[model samples]
Target: MSSSEQPVGEVQVHPQPAPPGSGPWARFVTWAGQDTIEDYSLRYAPKSFRKWSPMACAITALGGIAYLADYSIGASIAVSHGSASAVVAIIVAAVTIFLTGIPIAYYAAKYNIDMDLLTRGAGFGYFGSTLTSLIYASFCFIFFALEGSIMAQAMKLALHIPLALGYVLGSLIIIPLVLYGMTALAKFQVWTQPLWLVLFVAPIVFIATADPKGFNGFLTWAGDGGTERVTAIGVGAGAGVALSLIAQIGEQVDYLRFMPEKSETPPWRWWSAVLAAGPGWVILGAAKQICGAFLAFYVAGKVGFTAATEPIQQFLGGFGSVLHNDTVALAVATIMVLLSQVKINVTNAYSGSLSWSNFFSRVLHIHPGRVVWLGLHIAIALALMLGNMFAVLNTILGFYSNVAIAWIGAIVADLVINKPLLKLSPSYVEFKRAYLYSINPVGFVSMMVGSFFSILAFYNVFGDFMAAWSPYLALALAFFLSPVICILTKGKYYLVRPNPIREEIEKEPLWAGQTLLDIVDQKRYELPDMVHDCPFHGGTISSLTCTLTKCHDLCKTSAYIDSVTTATLRNAAEPQPTT
Candidate 1:
């Protein structure tokens, strides 16, 4: 009831039960019950919360996918499967990605929850979703290494930056930019997007304009063996490498969550932005892959056998062929790589921190802040770089794609099909720990089954060609199986209970951590600004730190008090206010 500033360390919050008349325990209990975030989870996504236009979100989401590795990944596929095979693989992967991402992007934007929370509410429960979080976190680091290596190579090839220095430069580069979250990321992407587009298209334009044979070379390119001569296994193996990039959806959702709520003013633009920037990003990605494949073939034609495998070399040759000076090509290439990696890695680093924070805060019950994890994630990628991880990209990414595909497939099924048509589960997303089972058989069983079968397929246990297309196997199986499991289970695994406080808040509104929770047992709403979700005895009046004190009374037995009681106790926990 007191009008005081938030305090520092050990701050307390919540209701005062006494009408200047109640006993100490009752008042403290009322206060303790009011500490909110402890029992609350992200709920009630609303239009008011979506402040950005769709265009801003699209750029931010797609910005991270622009790594020069597109060239390397495409080249590896091209060299292995021939240009035609790589072309087929690119189209297949792009179509697959767009379809898979549609549900995820729409759900994330509509629900205003991150992927981890979505996993929990979709069908995977608290502990079950943790597996996805780990999967997602692993995706962040793996891509961080891949993208960082590409940047480092650009540095090394263009500026002659020592590989060691390039590694440090590449790895540390994202931390500074991602620290600010989506706000800073949006501006950064906006400023850089134009130049990225220009640089990306320019070399292709020049190459095509100057050497029309370049196009012919790409089409007729035997590439070790022509397309018809392709072994199914070769195509499958190459596709697996490209499919690993499917996990990039996690990063895309990080931005899509910021998409402006749908409206009539510019409905077409909004939908266009969402489609183009959301899952539509795969179209751009596939295009880049085609470009990569073409340029890789061009480079092989020009550079001969020695450096044909590397895409940066492919790019350098493209520029040398298209431009006047080799030095100019090199400098432009380095800048392009630096800009591209910096953009996407900022997203990787940013999205990773959110992923890691959600991991620890929910599982371990602690949050130091988003910035701390930024450093930790980048450090991990740095360590991977020292190990020269890029050297083994093909094998590493191929194995990783299977699990990533399975996870995505399970999630997309729940969002697109499960929640909408059958009405077996609620359409509005629910993501709170207090109301979910430790595991949901629907998503969990589906993911496990998919992963199991896909891995077996990958190892040639399901025959040779199947082994090559293991990621697709996982995707297909998980997507088909998740809903079947949901139907058989009657979709019971989705929620523990509806938000108890829905009446007080808007329906489907996005909630911040500070959003108050009603701890009905203690009869008051928790104060929203406390640093600790748990009630504290007040220590100071300066900031959130001083806003709490522990329960002072001997009568209260349980440490796990409700939000309202915690709020009451926060007031009652302190020395009585001098009248």
Candidate 2:
């Protein structure tokens, strides 16, 4: 039997690589097919693999966020608060999302790390970031289930299928599509971009052309709240609900992390790609949210509040006005919902797997693979779907936004304030587990305080006014508190130990007559000259190494890189057979 298949006690000293087409599914299950290391789970994305142009990557990343959920969210807000508040809230949320997303997008692309990894070095520290991982993973699955629920509704409307089975099919469809990761997703997004854009705008255009009265209705709609003019509480509550989307930057980072190095690409192209794919997502999202409000307003008079809030129903009504036939309108709306849901859910599933992988690998000290986590994320989302998550959409998002905003706010403060203004934190992100402290109070404490207060306010613990503005409170506290804590701690907690090897190499030229190990002190380092494969980053390198004990203590056990010698040592340390 091959070494990979052999029992643990009889592990091979030098296991041979699996031959071509000899994997679990003959070939489809191979790591190559799975885009094994392309997404750079445990390490930085290398320059060689980031060959896609910035525009190509940006468009793909933007395409994934082209979901109908924005429409649902906008419609819900408009239905509850009226057109003025919904419009005000969407604008407020868009501006906030755009501003906060900038620093995160730049850093993720520049550093070549996902949101979880970025959170680690930005201020949260190594193990401190585990909390954000959970938050991020929750964002993925929650949105996945939400997007899936919408797809199921479309299925019920278009195919006349039962909601129970529709939920299962909707949840199951994206698994195979997301299995291949960014390589496949990039293509899917690019190919579908034109069609998605066409369908997305068509219903709005038809409303403008065929039913001008409907457009006017959207202008004066007061909604179920019976508030014609925007109120402070309404705006605050609406913004709070809308700001829950702050975590979307984390999703954008999932794609931005794949961006090629800026130095290698043209300056204009690189910056354009970074901004467009990063903070620029809100541009499109804002437009969709407005369209959703418009549609909700147009439909509310005919279908009632609850029914108007549903994207499938809203679009069905919109298309019905234009198409003049119920069957044709249903077909068009169903196809739009399916296309949009699939586009977004693949992203949700892919990012969730990455987040879960980071969280589990750090917490459990083992990572089976991204594919394993992918299935786990989908399964959880499916469970949520079965529980009828669609019914509690507003409650779930309003509550979730507080936690998400706190997490993003803290990270942004560290990047924008601590890193640049005060220089309290390190200028460059230090994600290597070996060099970072397990917990940095700067981000962790700030996030905790922010989330705690915001959540309390959300539940009316802080009274009605505070409850209405809880998300702003969360953002304010996290953003300001991060700098305060960084100043208080004096940035000493950012690193557990100084990385003298990295320090020494920075001063020398790349072509200097010395290897990276030549600068590393042999007495302080371990496994010198042997290649080290980072368990977290999935990169193989020979420039640096540390002892198993040191690796466990500093890097966390799961992120420890393995050299040939270390592998053999690990094997030897395993319990020996009896006579």
User: Quick one: RMSD of model 2?
Assistant: 8.7
User: Please, what are the lDDT tens digits per residue for candidate 2 over residues 1-579?
Assistant: 452353221111111134576665333234422234325454455444566889888988998997888998998888888888889988999999999999999989976778987898889987899999999999999999888888989998889998889888988889888877778889999999999999998998898789877777565578887477887777788887788788998888888887876666799999999999999999889999889988888887788888888899889988888899999999999999999999999999989988887787677654456776787899999999999888888789999999999889999999998999999888777776666788999999999999999999999998988988899898999999999999999998897654544454335323111222212222111121222333433433332222111345623343342343487789999999999
Tens digits of per-residue lDDT for model 1, 252-344:
877776665543327787667767776887778888888887887887867763356565676676776667688888887777778888888
How far does residue 435 in candidate 2 sit from its true spot (Å)? 0.7
What is residue 479's positional error in candidate 2, in angstroms? 0.7
lDDT (C-alpha) at residue 514 in model 2? 28
What's the C-alpha lDDT at position 202 in model 2? 91
Q: How accurate locally is residue 558 in candidate 1, as Cα lDDT from 0 to 100?
A: 39
Candidate 2 backbone collisions, by pair = 42-536, 42-537, 43-537
Whose TM-score is greatest here? 2
How accurate locally is residue 469 in candidate 2, as Cα lDDT from 0 to 100? 88
TM-score for each of the candidates: 0.80, 0.85
